[model samples]
Target: MGTEFLNIKDSVDAKNLIQEYFNKYYEPEGEEIPIEDSNGRVVFEDIYAKIDFPPFDRALKDGFAIKSEDSFGASEENPKVLKVIDALEAGSYSKKTVENGLAVEISTGSPLPEGADSVLMFEYSLKNGDEVELYTSVTPTQDVGKKGSDVKEGNLLIKKGTVLSASKIGVLAAQGFTTVKVYKKPNISIISTGNELTELGEELKPSKIYDVNSYMIKNAAESIGASGTIKGIVKDDYNQLKSKILECLEEYDILICSGGTSAGVGDVLKHVLDEIGEVKLHGIAVQPGKPTILGVIGEKLVIGLPGNPVSSLVIFNVFVAPAIRSLLGLKESSLKKVEGKLTKRIHSAIGREQYQLVKYDDGKVEPIFKDSGAIFSLARADGYVNVSKNTELVEEGEIVEVNLFN
Candidate 1:
């Protein structure tokens, strides 16, 4: 008997099912890695500042460090002259304090000497033998970077579940952190199934096409911080497909397969999944991706994507990406959405939600209508617009929301 979809689920219900199932089985663990490798990883715990930034009062400009009161009445016409006791460059300290009539020549980033509360820029002062003339007055703490000003001690620097960026890594470096605790990335095994598919770098046969889904899906997973491993291609054979999946499940946290998921006689993925584990859902109520399959072997997720390259990626962005993000303790749907008016009218299946690929430019959204198998259609699209399942036709000039690709 040919396999058939027993109960098809709408897009919303399907997503909810995948999320709920994964959340129940998977919990991300934390790992300590060097700060150099922490970028793009989620923080496993809150990080706090142990000490004040700057740690001491430092000069912000190259000039003389003096007691502010000494320059209170100084001006260009009648400059105040003070004995230059010592010179302090960046990374150096002055032993002598700035007494009532004394000044210390300090460079930028040098710690301020005791009793010196302000810095006078070199432009406003003239250096002579043993003395410097100050032409401008300075207030207390002027040009002085105070301790704890940038970051106070015990302040929460990075919150748990925050994704680390380049600047965040710099902050950790500033705190003298050699390593950080981050949520471990999920390991995914990607498999492509089709007799007519050939691997890249191999000679193309008469009717075989090079595999696209494995590489595309791998990069897509990596873009979202998951570790994807391409398990190469497997022909449409029941025993071979089942054996490959079983092997992947033994090592990977998730398994993603492309093709052989429809109701056709040769589409044996559903049957293999049924025999090995459980086929949770066989079909989705979405145009171009209705043959998608969701299954599980124990705690490992096995997803069967449509053979069409465009459909495989679209369904991935819709369902698999979010599920992976959830496992990593990240908020799903990070893609930005913008409002735009359609350039022309379009038709969609009445009962199945449609993800109409479009080229969005300057508030004008032009729909790129092509078959699901057309890879160029996805390449030409900047994003996609979701048409509701209840709606059949969208009139021209109608404003719609476009979800921009990352």
Candidate 2:
């Protein structure tokens, strides 16, 4: 008898869907030159140290190099005197060999002489005639830094797909890398849809709102070091929406259309994506964003986010943010999610995941307005709290992880 495969629908969580969608698409990747150019770019290659840091052993102090045994038992009460056979300046290499009871004068960063194993501070000893007196005892390897102490040659510095930072550049430079290779930055495109919307500078008519999605989304793209181009506003017509998205998709790796995912406005944006390519997932069981659409547009990406500013940003933070990071080839972002106490109880229905927009103040989180459409509420927010479907209605004083915007 043949067994039937169990069709487990809804078993795949948001994470699983995210992973499945991620595995299907290979983001745009390329190589870039220069250290600063690699800042937002992802590491395409594992970077190894070509040479050891501090390549050579040098004097750690502007003092005299001497044998450790020569300064043994020397103290402030009774000082030991050794002849300063020769003096070496900074950047100079000392060839003199310090035998027993002999000291070689050396400056900071100067290479240690052939036989010297320690250095004595200038303050502890006085130089008179041709010799210097040491008042302190010295230990083996005292005041001497060893080569490769900071880093070793051939050691892995940064793995591929790691976004290089300022300090990362310093490490590469230390490894003698004047030029570093990294993935090229992705080009982002932003478009807003709504017949009742006008541009920012235009006069706001009574029932119509100005186009805020384009500016806001473009700013978000710029924040991540992404190059953004506003494709202007597309009327809530399916044909126009289709034409605009398809046209902009050609010039950008990621195309974003905001405000038309809802059912009321004919959902021209959502339909455009479906007609062009397969919509991976239509509705997410999440709050602040339910009509979210994630789809593949040929080799590019087209996302249909909610029209509400707060809802759109919430979805961006939850889903699109990681996608952007993946596209940039950045390492796992070090964005810390902080836990804060809830100021009041929040009731949410069981079934859909909820991302509550809350303002953190004095170690507490306060929910925003009833709806996530309020833009001003979002502006004042610090982060969000993710409430699972099965577990809703958080009591006051309960601690929750808050994703800080900063």
Candidate 3:
């Protein structure tokens, strides 16, 4: 064992360093993709409505289009009668206009004919021969979908940097958009380092474990809209690690590696980073992830996570996830958090910020304290609560914010 970290930074300072570096160098470009594939993608530019929704006045129900005055004083006892001039269905326009005492039979979504200001629903009118007897009165525009009522022309529909959802895509489809301009997804390469790690599905040799960090970290990046490619596992050999990282940097926007980040005889990731690129940060003052590393090579960013599975994911969520989101032009505040009361008291290292894993259930948060290397700790946890460095203990029944994994 060796003292690997000489100078450690607080978690807040570490986050600021990442933000400052990415803000200066990373500027994502936009690409046009089919609208059907735009969901969950970030918008590169503001999208405006080119035309009005409903383009023209249309019927909101299967009914008759008529002047509102023509239905005045209409009731079950004393009904008003109007001659049906023409019948209109959706996508068809009627050239005929409604005059006084005249109505046009209209189907739902059909464009309202000229000289009509209201629609009488079929339930309120009885068709007798070519005339409809109205049993109820209506006001102008009643049961009528007016032009530009839902969306007006030239209105800003989607703002830049907004993530497209199903509803937003529907709005674009309504405007006849077959494709949309979205920020290109950032490509990230995920690597796991350790001689004790073996590839999944391979026969597990004695004293070796299957590689978990590569698959775990890859999915985490992809969940946030970045394209992830797993580069498999690398041993503790410095030259091999350096060659792999350099190759990945040539093509990927970011490279993330887990394991072999701590200061030990077998930990060679720091030495490789020092020779190939500038190490911006060597350690962070956070529990379960103090040996986290951040670096930059050329224009691409590099991150090293702890060997411990729990520590690796916690640091990724706190530090790497935001960087990925920034490069994709998405909001950094995407993690969902909820408030809950602690089920029991908890203690932490006074000088280090602690991310205490907890199982949140119906506003109650129960601490799940397991060793950092324990992968099951993360599986049992719904989220974690950030305990400040200055605070050493949190009493039971105290309220805290839990950052959810999903």
Candidate 4:
């Protein structure tokens, strides 16, 4: 039996329904992983500093460490002279203390001497043998970095649910953390279904095309921190397709099948979902990807996307990517976008949201109109423009928001 198209859902409502169902039943779990492998992963718990950063009063400049009282009122006109007592490099400490007429030569990051309270920059001081003349007055604690001033012990470092960046990794290293707790990546299974699909290494036949959706979808999943594997292709056979999907659901958190989602006689993905599990959504009011399917089987989410490369990618970016992020407790706006002006007018179906592939030029976006099934449709474009379902025509020179594919 053909699936119903009379009740195709609005794209926004469909996404909301998926999110609500996910929040009700799914809870993301966490695991401890090495910091080296934790980049881009969401933090599972709050992290705190175990010890104070710097851990000691350090020098902020390469100059002389001295008592501010001795350098007080000193200037270029009448320089103050002091004997060098000792020299301290970075990671070294001084045993001798600075007296009234003595100074300690200190390098940046060197611990402040016992009796020295300020650092005099080398530019402001002149050295002749062991005696130095200070030409500028320095206040107490000037150019001195105090311990615990930057990061105090037991202070919160990274808050829960924050995405770990390279800078955050450095912060964890400062806290002496070799490993961190992060949300576990969702495991996904991708199956490309079509009688006209062939493997990459196989010789091309007139009627068959290489399976691009499987590999493309796999990388798309990986982009969102989800581990995806191609579970091979399933031809247009109801029994075999149903068996493979059921088997995949047993081992994966999400099952994604490309093709066979339309209302044609050969499109049996929706029927298979109905037979084995729940078909939550049959179609969406979207251009190029109106034949999308969203369902659930057992505890796993099952999604069927169109066979066309451009349509498959658009649907995954709009639906699957966000769903994967939500399962991992990540924000929906994780992907960044830019806004630009349209170079020309574009038309869209009044009742369906349209995504047109476009190239961004000096602040102007030029739409790329090509066959959806052609690989060059998206290859020549930098990003895509979203036109609302109610928007029938977009005029030239209009400011439009562009969603980059990267």
Tens-digit lDDT track of model 1 for 1-406: 2788859999999999988878877897889999999888999999999889978999999999999999988999999999999999888998897899999999999999999999999999999999999999999999999988899989999999999999999999988999999989999999999999999999998999999999999998998889999999999899999999999999999999999999998788999999999999889999878999999898888999999998998899887788888877788645578999999898998999999889999999999989999988878898888999999999989999998766
**Please, what is the TM-score per model?**
0.97, 0.86, 0.96, 0.93
Better of 3 and 4 by lDDT: 3
* Candidate that scores best on lDDT: 1
- On the 0 to 100 scale, the lDDT of residue 313 in model 3 is 90
Instruction: Report the CA-based lDDT of candidate 1 relative to the real structure.
Output: 0.92
Candidates, ranked, TM-score: 1, 3, 4, 2
Q: Which pairs clash in the backbone of model 3?
A: none
Q: What is the Å distance of residue 240 in model 1 from its true position?
A: 0.4
Residue lDDT tens for model 4, 1-406: 5666546889999888777766665688999999999999999999999999878888999999999999988999999999998888888999898878899999999999888899999999999999999999999999999989899999999999999999999999988999999999988999999999998899989999999999999998998889999999899899989999988988888889999998988888988888888888878898879898888887778889999999999899887788789877688776768888898899999989998889987788998887678777777888789999999999999999888877
User: Model 3 misses residue 230 by how many Å?
Assistant: 0.3
Q: Order of candidates by lDDT, top first?
A: 1, 3, 4, 2
Tell me the spans in candidate 2 whose CA falls farther than 4 Å from its real position.
1-15, 27-30, 37-42, 95-102, 160-165, 221-227, 329-334
What tens digits encode model 3's per-residue C-alpha lDDT throughout 116-178? 999999999899999899999999999999999988999998899888999999999999999
RMSD of 1: 1.3
Pairs clashing in candidate 1? none
